[model samples]
Target: MELEAAAALGKYLGAGIACLALAGAGIGVGNVAASFLNGALRNPAAAKEQTATLFIGLAFAEALGIFGLVVAMLLLFAV
Candidate 1:
């Protein structure tokens, strides 16, 4: 009812919405891993060579998730 309460509610809602970005990151990570496994199964020898690529993909995906979390935190606490 009051302005302050409504603003706080909006901030919380915004933070929650921002956190949804993590879902994309989760899907990206899963896709990368699944694709790597699929390829590795077909060519076992090449799996070792692709291992670094897989890790890089995982790290990038995880970083996106972390960025989303940070944005959510900033919305809730700072903005």
Candidate 2:
């Protein structure tokens, strides 16, 4: 019984650590947006050309957050 309790505790702790990736993803998204905005403000004409890249960066950042969520879920329920 004590071993089962220890396993459960470990799983919860691991899940919590995995969730930190979400925080990193948030910071990454913010940095990408800030950099794009800074560049666009300086060069209004070029902003149109780089819009696609900006969106790609945002998508990647969001994907990372989603991946983190999945890992946490799996750790909590599957492992």
Candidate 3:
């Protein structure tokens, strides 16, 4: 029973770590988008062509967040 309790505690801690990663990702993605928009607005003509690239950057940022969520799920289910 003690061992089982320990395992459960470990799982929760692991999940918490994953959640922290997600929080960091949220902040990071927000920074990325905010900066991109600020820059785009300041110089719309040049930035027009780069819109696709900007979206790719945004996707990559959000993907990192999803990865963190995946890790959390794995910790709770796979481990």
Candidate 4:
């Protein structure tokens, strides 16, 4: 019973951390978008080139958010 309670507490704490990662990812994605916009404004002709790189940046930022979501799910289900 004690072990079960301990596991439950640990799982809940881990889930909290996982949720925090989403906030970090949000900040990162915002930064990426802001930089891309700034670059595009500086050179309208380079917007096309910047778009591709912006997507790559977004993919990485979003992947971290997805990982956090997966961890939250795992904690809720597997734990």
Backbone collisions counted per model: 0, 0, 0, 0
Task: Show the colliding residue pairs in model 3.
Answer: none
lDDT of 3 by residue, 1-79 (tens): 6998999999989888888777878897899889888988999888888888778888888899999899889889998
Preferred candidate (TM-score higher): 2 or 3: 2
lDDT of 2 by residue, 1-79 (tens): 6999999998899899999999999999999999999999999999999999999999999899999999999989998
> Which scores higher on lDDT, 1 or 4?
1
lDDT of 3 at 77: 95
Q: Give the TM-score of candidate 3.
A: 0.80
Candidate 1 local lDDT, 1-79, one digit each (tens): 8999998999899899988889999999999999999999999999999899999999999999999999999988887
Give the winner by lDDT: 2
TM-score of each: 0.84, 0.81, 0.80, 0.83
Q: Cα deviation in Å at residue 14, candidate 3? A: 1.2
Model 4: weakest 10-residue lDDT segment is 44-53
Which stretches of model 3 miss by more than 4 angstroms? none
Which segments of model 4 are wrong by more than 4 Å?
A: none
Tell me how far the alpha carbon of residue 79 in candidate 1 is from the true structure, in angstroms, after superposition.
3.7
Give residue 77's lDDT in candidate 4 (0 to 100): 91
Best by TM-score: 1
Better of 2 and 4 by lDDT: 2
**Candidate 2 collision pairs:** none
* Displacement of the residue 21 alpha carbon in candidate 2, Å: 1.0
